[model samples]
Target: MKISATILAAATLGSLFAAPALAQETLNFGIISTESSQNLKQEWVPFLAEMEKQTGFKIKAFFAPDYAGIIEGMRFNKVQVAWFGNKSAMEAVDRAEGEIFVQSVDAEGNPGYWSHLLVHKDSTLNSVQDVLKNAAELTFSNGDPNSTSGFLVPGYYVFAQNGVDDPKKIFKRVINANHETNAMAVANKQVDVSTNNSENLRLVQARQPEKFANIKVIWTSPLIPADPIVWRKDMPKDAKDKIKTFFLTYGVAAPGKSQDQVKKEVETLAGLQWAPFKPSSNDQLLPIRQLELFKNRNKIAGDANMSETDKKAKLAEIDAKLADLTKRMAALK
Candidate 1:
């Protein structure tokens, strides 16, 4: 009986020691809603499986109906890591204790991508001018509020610069949807114009050629930085190192990899519209921060509802931020 009791006590102690290891083996990876969850999963599953194989963690994909859901998930520690555009990454960094560890490279070797304003091929809106001039008669489909290419880039370069404070107020109707839905809506004539991105439009072209055939680009914004991979700042250092190593090496031609293995890995990245990953930090968000400040400045400049005294004070504040950002950006150069 004494020997049995000692064995039982030893086993219990071992199980207690094992519990945390088991817990650490699972990681929830959040994916923002760029398209339908089904489509996103189709592109991500193989890559995530590879990550699981490499890192020895049971990787699960977490999807939300909107960008904010992923942000909130990370805030609550339910999501350990995520892929986020510059604007959304800023939100995550500022609000969710997230840190950018890596950025995705474009498959075609482009340094960055562009935001697009799309109209149906059959529509008369051939340019940004035509759309703005006819805003009173058209329904505009914008993107998720948190989207960088879909929202912030266009919001600044398109409407804000034109002194239009709100597209919803000027257009006949305005609605928000994801990149895929926006492209589809324009193709189907559900809306006259919508915002999309070059990367996503390429996917539409490949995945739904018929829809692609019906779409036309009316305007494209300046180049925007590639997307970033963010992990919660509080994640274990060992886990973070493993994840960083996985991203920085995946899809690259390694010495031991067979030609077929390299080919398959490259193809998987292509499906996600990315090349191998590059190391990045929160500094990647500087241009996005500038864009936001500019947009806010425009809003303040156009706000007739505010007293002149208040408006001037707000504008001064934004200008101070812009100047500081400009100096920081210049220093990087």
Candidate 2:
């Protein structure tokens, strides 16, 4: 049957666009590598397998080398869904228009973790103050700038409150590493002091007990928000719903799987998954954003290019705003 040229062109274009709408081909999930990338891929096999079975989409991982990599990937739409640290997730939400759908809980099913500043077991440093006092004499390592416990919590709770001009500058030298590397650095005495997390320290303990045991947590920050599972806000609604269901229902029983069997699967990734989790919103990161704002304000105060008069005026303005935020946060109780 001959068709009109206009109709033929319309049909061809429709098919081209409709192909994806008809079949959900692949889900590109971005994961920031806190540990070794190889281990992450391997540990994810069971979870990914179940996700694929439930969602009917071939899942491919975008294993980013650092926290910023995944954030940037989501910003450019190279990543549709991602597992992100709280601070990194905040970055994704702010810069990539990402939304938080769920958060991970601990082994005890609590949605939080500790931010720790670590020192060698044999080191004389006894507290965060010790590190600050010896800042000019010691080397330091901060977690990825976007990490929650690694950078955000410690950056605010430890370094910022200490009145240190810059944690990076106070230390004789500064380096950036992931949680695992930071723990190992403290263990090996490669860095005099480093920021880490209780959960990541536990992970290292599981994989290398000796190294983990040698590193001691000198200071611990108050409970911080757990890592969040995020997806691009522009993702298809149906896909987002399905993905949410996959997480909310994971480790639950299926036709052939026993509840205990499912429990074991989630247990294997203790620090990564939360079997009984709750949906979250962008507001989960308000405190984190506030911290970043304070950090930026401090940087402005230390601006060498600004005239002394201007710098003092800016500092006064920032301090007033910060005081208001502090009061509001306290009132949240």
Candidate 3:
């Protein structure tokens, strides 16, 4: 559902501006590059400028080379704000005491996206079942192991299902690369199939339509939660409040000449004119949580030398836990 920020800000301008200046300087926003730095700068520079202008503080965007780079930045507390995928976000929160503040809504206002398994148009692969049977013979391209749609989610949903008994023993090869490289590898026929996010695939195709002309989606996973914007524990409290306010109410109509400017800012950040970011919580991240449980179970099963009874008991425990996880995930709004 879409949220409107203008309605919330009608209370008073004094409250929004009550923060002290000393606290504002401590906010350093970090953005992970799912796309290239150049592309990210193009899309986010204006948005950052608008946020700084509105908040009366200089908000710097700390760009990272890759997923690992961002993780390191957050771990050291060099970054105060971070945009993270579900898997990487969990890592950031666990290791850096980062808390999620905001999540992006799609053009349709949905809070999540999906993982897609794609193949070349002329390939004989027709379904997920077909791909699994020939898994050993085909070269697979997965994004970083920490990636949500790229690796963790896809692996947990697909490979982990077979108990991860070293599934690659059935596969010809596996390659871990950035999402863009994974797309190119499949397009160039270097890999027969690869896992990617539908949203990112759309962005890639928008940039180079010809490269993906021969590729088609073969499988799509259940809706995965969108990435989250997180804040470090060491950040100044007033600055944190200001950041949250700006994110929550930036796009809604404001009185006087600022109304048009607010609308423009919203469009730049969210691509939907005058739309507000709704309140989100960890509860919406149930899919990623489920994936984590599946991974843990697979690790237990992969133990090289387990007694027959212990193996059976572990298997039974996994089934029972998974059933509970499924029920909880389904119940999440």
Candidate 4:
């Protein structure tokens, strides 16, 4: 009888210990490597602290050396939520079980940001034309393959449109790095030219004014959509609701927030280079998808090694996809 009683007590204690573990879930939030993890953590820690306080989930920040790391993290269910640029987010949604729930708004109220081709202020390169014309003489610092502004935007608008499908064939040397590193590389003359974005340039201006001053924008791509916040579609409904509510209300003037509270939240958001979270859906990826297809079409058309028959068939497939995307975009409008 004593043995049976001890077993019952042990089971009860085990259940008690496990109940809190089940109730208090830990959420890992992944941030793509736009800059160094240290810089990102400085801008993100306070905001994540607030998320923890408001959502009642233990929030942890996850950073990767490259954008693909975060995408793979979500694919394996290691990251519950993440902030992803358009191109990476498209990859995530298509490859991982990811869904876009909210998007960032620029602190300056701009609807979107521009991608830039940068050179040292003292460099002779004055435009994209000059860079392309002199490509064989200059070493180029490119953005990560997964970066939209760093690679995709410029890949299409600059190289593909000009009939140069691969940068490696033209440039003397091609090196890939994050925006911050690329900007600094140009400023320090480590590379002749590199890709960056308006948002990160603003950060460089604030963090390293001297470097920012030495960098000149030789060319700018058309506006790219703001970044998106994605979470695994399998995230619990209650957790999703809490996360969405926390983001949408964080910097906004809510009824219960004191003036000081609102001001503090605003400043926190400004540090992150955003205003407030706006509700978003997968439809935000439509423009990015169209851009990808357009870039592929151009590449196919420019490929000299491909047979005419194969090129025609590949281009036709990309064109059909582009047309379908166009129709979907029109329907949205």
Find the candidate with the highest lDDT and give its number.
1
Question: What C-alpha lDDT, on a 0 to 100 scale, does residue 311 get in candidate 2?
Answer: 85
Candidate 3 accuracy as TM-score: 0.82
Worst 10 residues of 4 by lDDT: 1-10
Tens-digit lDDT track of model 4 for 16-131: 22334633556778898889888988999999898888877777788888999899888876677899999999999999889999999998998778999999999999999999
Where does candidate 3 have its weakest 10-residue lDDT segment? 1-10
C-alpha RMSD values across all candidates: 7.3, 7.1, 7.2, 7.4
Query: What's model 4's overall lDDT?
Result: 0.87
Model 3, CA-based lDDT:
0.72
User: Residues 212-255, candidate 1, lDDT per residue (tens digit)?
Assistant: 99999989899999999999887766778778988987887777
Error at 32, model 3, angstroms: 2.0
Error of 4 at 195 (Å): 0.2
| Model 2 deviation from the true structure expressed as Cα RMSD, one decimal place | 7.1
Per-residue lDDT of model 3, residues 12-100, tens digit only: 32343355544244345677666667767777778778778766766677876667767767666556677788888888877876778
Per-residue CA lDDT of candidate 2, range 1-333, in tens?
111111112224224223355334566688886877876776666677767777776667777778888887777766778888888998899898799999877766666888999999999999988988898999999888888888888888887776765787788999999888888889999999999887777678888999987988899898888878898786666777778987876766667778887777667555354455567877678677778778767677667899998988888887887787778778766
RMSD of 1: 7.3
lDDT per prediction? Answer: 0.88, 0.77, 0.72, 0.87
* Runs in model 1 lying further than 4 Å from the true structure: 1-24
- lDDT winner between 1 and 2, please give it: 1
